[model samples]
Target chain A: MGLLVVFGQIYDPAINAAALAFDRALRADLPDGVIETVPTFRSVLVRFDPLEISCPRLEGHLQELLARQDWLQAEPDDAAQHWVLPCVYGGARGPDLGKVADLMGRREDQVVAAHAAVELRVAMLGFSPGLAYLGQLPEAWNLARRSTLTPEVPAGSVLVAVRQTVLPATPIPTGWHAIGQTPFRAFVPAHRRPFLLAPGDRLRFEPVAEPCYAAFDQADFLRKSGG
Target chain B: MSGLEILSIAANATIQDAGRPGFLRYGLSAGGAVDPYALAEGQALLGNAPDDAALEFAGAGGRFLARSDVWLATSGAEMTLTVNGDARPWRQSFGLRAGDELRLGPPQTGVYAYLHVAGGFQTEQVLGSRSTHLRAGLGTVPRPGIVLPFRADLPHSQQPLKLPRPGSFSRRCFRVLPAPQADLFSAETRQRFLAQEFRIGQMRDRMGMRLEVEGSAAFQAETGLSIASDATNLGDVQITGDGTPVVLLVERGSAGGYPRLVTVISADLAALAQVPSGELIRFQEISRDDAVVELRKYRREINTLKDLVQPVFRDPHQISGLSGMNLIGGVIRGDEEDNHDDD
Candidate 1:
């Protein structure tokens, strides 16, 4: 059985901070039968082995941990890793760039500038393997996902919607608008550490021309922790 | 140095083991053989480690040429097997010499089948497992001209053995426990779900399977259908916007927003996986204690399969697809007579 600890009704950085802190604490001093913990936008899902521990008992233990802190006001973890990756925006690489710019009532270059202006936090890794959802973009950037899916988006495609940015390591169908393409590889199964960015890791994108982005050795860039 | 060379293969054939758990936080699901009971039975027959990797074939298996003398065991979804162009019985261990061709045909009843080698397949481990997660691009799919390696140094003196085939392939009634959002579904809706005989839909895969309920009135939650996307569990029966019920499987996503009405218990998931598309199925509500007790009993049953392995008493008629081969005494003679009649 799994226990979900939800902090709020909607997405909030403060709630995410509390959830991440709680996740770390639980992992550091795990309860018996606690298989794993997954932190998301405003909640943490603690999966436990039902055979080893009953749901009520696990719930009581989590209640005690929840009462230990005012997680809503807790500061974000300082140990979170930061990365700045090179991205190519508004071209054939990202077919929906023009559409997204038009929706925002801004030029393509302005959209790119606005996207690269802010640092985002990796709220969660989900939907697909190594797909990170980085979020809390300014309210002005909040946009709805496409009514129909784009059918397929290549790996390293940077997607934005609902005040969040998503980076996929493999081809997938998405409702989000493809704003740019990144040279960095977010997931490499052959590497010792397959997933490059953890849930709480912070990241920023540096806009680069298509020609310069093509010269990068993706594996090498990932090894250097983003060049 | 011992291995098997793929002569021809169908799509979706790959190496799998018990699966990689504890990685769901990274958006990766535990992707193992859909029919894990079959995997266990084959491993028991060959005396391999519990987590030893084996070939998981979806629908149909392929033709393989043994690169060296090796013992092989087949289990799950009774399929047609032929060694060196001679019909062989499924669910039994047999030996193949260097350059012997082993062919596997389409399954007769179930959707998944397992093939086991003496020492297990020596494939490179990714994230502590050999199970292929196709959505994650974690492992390579077995294709023609690829060589699956295994340990040749191990002793190969074990006798040919067979176990009773799994009975779960035909199972239609699966027991389910309440999911986190079960309360959102009213008593009437829950009762309707139990009363309904749902047919498996055509859109099925490792990720999830959609169940087709009768008529346009699918089970609807009076309290709306959308929930904040939270971590999802395997076997979760999630209700989509159109009121369709989808049971998430081994390769399910880590998180989803749909309201989950119930979750099938772990003990019956393997059985549910074998139930082919277009088949009728029903769900039975089970309490938490009952589900735990059932799971324990299922694990014990699987653990004791090794004791049930017995020497194969040749019964060509009892086995399907054996009509083409010549029938002799209880024992059959072939070019490799000594190895074929181990008893």
Candidate 2:
């Protein structure tokens, strides 16, 4: 097949929903010879080998596909629609929860309530392999990213910055504020599809009690389908 | 079987062919010989195919002991090649006896060198290639006392060794084509890039080489634009956030975030590969058509070289001098009377 391009808009409570929507639209229409499409907060990067397809031809095909937007009407099947991610907020699991609450001038409970208030869409998987950038956080919980980046944040960290939540798939340096930790590993390299979360899928992080952390191991939960 | 046993191998040495391509999507770089031209030339000296995997030595070449009688050749930036404490010729094949020690000293001309055995270095191929990805640490270096295996039957050679034309090894001006994001830079900055001379920074490797541009004006107007990271290839001159231009090499990152000002032509990548650190480099802009013409010329030269070494066959039925024979009077002269002739 040649190139297939589709256009659409996606909505999340926090951050810019339009950008995520564009990425989902791009993935749905990728043609043959495309290894993988890289999505960001603003645009999608469609990569192809020049030997298989020329740059000018690919660019021209993309322009035509983008012009047609019929694929947006097709709803995501029930199996691909949404995912419920279990999270533990505050305490050692979320070291920056208190700091985030302080910055927003809100109580810890209020911050937790606001985070679970709306369904977030997986905007993109970037900054690192399999790291899902989920958005948009409620305006009340919206905050700027830290001025200085943390040297190495652990994997499965539920980070909040610029009014969005990011679940890092691997240990990486980030400027986001750590508000919580998730027992569910969104990314597992050994799995056939390493990343469970894909752009356009809905994500809702449910807060759990601190005592519940002992009942499950983060690594084991990642091994199984649902935490 | 004839083979070369490792005596003193350095880090990053591995068997490399003509890079594993078509796997960029799998997050794997086409890991191949850093100096493919030299590798090909070394193989050509043994009358072997260009795709044969040869030992690629990085940083410092290693010491090896010939385990059996075999032919070997070395090519790349001039490294001190010696056999049994006596120097052997570079880019030409020579017979080596058992127990002979072959040593390659630090690179004096280029960073990487290719060592090819008559029957290529036999190594386990992964993903259809023996090329090593050092950053990923997939392959192990040749350890001291390691015995390398090879096939006993060597390909029969019919022609004498034909040397490749000596190429310029020193650093010099490189021809560049405008990159996809060349227009992102200001006109003044672009002009400054063309006018200025850049020094190869010490932070150079197979992945990339940082070029230290002398004046700050090289990035004056294009200071703070945040460009999205994208895949880059060799010769891509990316401007880092700090304003220095880093010329990407063979094993460059699958993608990058810096703005690329220009891309060096594929034909000139070999020349740029030989450029040593601290060497002065200047960029000369050329049209895309001109770049293609240069690449075509290189391809033609290779084809011509290949034709020169092709084996020739003889036809026994077609006898020479048949047309030159003339009937000497009524009776044929010389031996014509004894042989069968038209009555």
Candidate 3:
């Protein structure tokens, strides 16, 4: 059995640049049998088939690849599908908006502006199937996750937590602040590729009035076709 | 016509064959018999194929009235078996006449027991298996009035049942292979895992078993990694953010994000499946080669046992003499005093 060696520190939260660089380097050197590699703010998970390659072998391969440092650090790929998600930001649609604005010491409109201003990147899709974690929320809107989790949140609920935005793909429990609700469904099981959003995709939240929200809701545009 | 009619069906009675394997890539777990060894043993006793379907009774067993004469065998933890109020020996095949009542009591020792008919239970194969996936709602349970079909052509012989050597089913040590993320823990934490005996927590089922590791050590870093949700198989021990160890089982989700610490070997997985709550469990790390060797030994033993029972059909003369003596021991005799306790 060959050795599969993994390089880099176990997990470090501060340096996203180092994590991204290491991900690219590992991909360039070891492409075969690398089913998928998911990079987070701190660490990376490289998965492979155990039958095809033993853990020791994979570990050794990683160690050698890291030592050589032959791979170049490429820029983040900009080729991503952009999606404009329509959302109702206040009232029943956004129950936590006032609370979040109070926590941030900003008005409701300013909180909405901060949320919609930045172009969020889909860092990863995990925690549940099709749940995409979008990151780099505006500095003013950065907030910690709720102290306790809500029993259950409906699917398509748009939440914000720790400088990131999450478009839930399923009916899952969460501790994040549900700042708004989206009429655009991000995941549809019936589609050829169920998740409309991918790890590298970009999202822009477009605010809508209550009347427009009602129209979108009545039209059922959020529900996937044939869903 | 040959069939077995249900007199009383237990709460969790369901048909199971050798589980559906090699489907993890498609987001499906291999769901099958809770106790594969007992299921295979029941088939071997009746000279049936290893993959034949059988009724897996959980916690409590059921009652059945034989509609026609048929050969059947029962195996797993010493459960009481009765034929028309008379006790019948277990782990052995015997003939049941029409209108004969067969009753099974609660397990005296183990968690699951298997009942195998000479002709395998007839059920539609779904996704390449006759196994019932309760979570997926794929197969219907045996109802009280349901009639199950059997093969009429099966040759009947009154051979002495071969009983397995009795072994204690109490607390036992399990062997495991170190997981991919095993190195993530400090050397002391790893040592603690080997030295400390953890109790099986209350949260356990077909999906996973939660182990209570008292006085938890700082196992993994506070900062976590976002691992891509990939295939998670049986015996894979995953550690959550809170440092609790959860061993995934037969019906576990196809993928997960938690860091895995170890994967128990295939040979020891059966032992892990039957471990009840509050039972003490400890892990012993073994090499992958050793694990494969142990698995081979178990398979060889079963194959040898199957061959031992195959010759009775060809030599009918040997069984005919023993049939007259009534091989069924522990049967209640004609004592009116003994019948009073039953009421």
Number of the top-ranking candidate, with TM-score as the measure = 1
Best by lDDT: 1
- Mind giving the per-residue lDDT tens digits that candidate 1 earns over B1-343? 6899999998878888988888888888878877778899999989899889999887878999999877789998888998878888888877776888999999888888889998789887888888888888776578899889988986453456789877787789999988878778889888889889999988888888899987758777777424557778888999988899999998898888888899999899889888888999999998888988998888888999998887766544564344233222223332233443333
Query: Over 4 Å off in model 3, which ranges?
Result: A1-94, A116-122, A139-142, A181-227, B1-171, B213-244, B250-261, B292-343
Candidate 3 docking class: incorrect
lDDT (10s digit) by residue, model 1, range A104-210: 89999998999999999988888888889897688878898899987889999999988889999889999999888998887788777888888889899999999
In model 1, what are the clashing residue pairs, if there are any?
none
Backbone clash pairs for candidate 2 read A10-A21, A13-A136, A14-A136, A14-A137, A15-A136, B77-B110
For residues B111-205, could you state the per-residue lDDT of candidate 3 as single tens digits? 67788888788776666677776654445468798877777787433353555633525636888887766776666777777777888887876
Question: Which wins on lDDT, candidate 2 or candidate 3?
Answer: 3
TM-score of each: 0.92, 0.69, 0.62
The segments of candidate 2 whose C-alpha lies over 4 angstroms from its true place after superposition are A1-62, A69-227, B1-5, B12-15, B23-28, B46-52, B67-71, B95-98, B118-126, B141-162, B165-171, B216-225, B299-343
Model 1: what is its DockQ?
Answer: 0.62
Tell me the alpha-carbon RMSD of every candidate. 3.9, 11.1, 8.8
Better of 1 and 2 by lDDT: 1
Over A102-170, each residue of candidate 2 has an lDDT whose tens digit, in order, gives 999989999888887778876656545457767777676568888998897777789997677888766
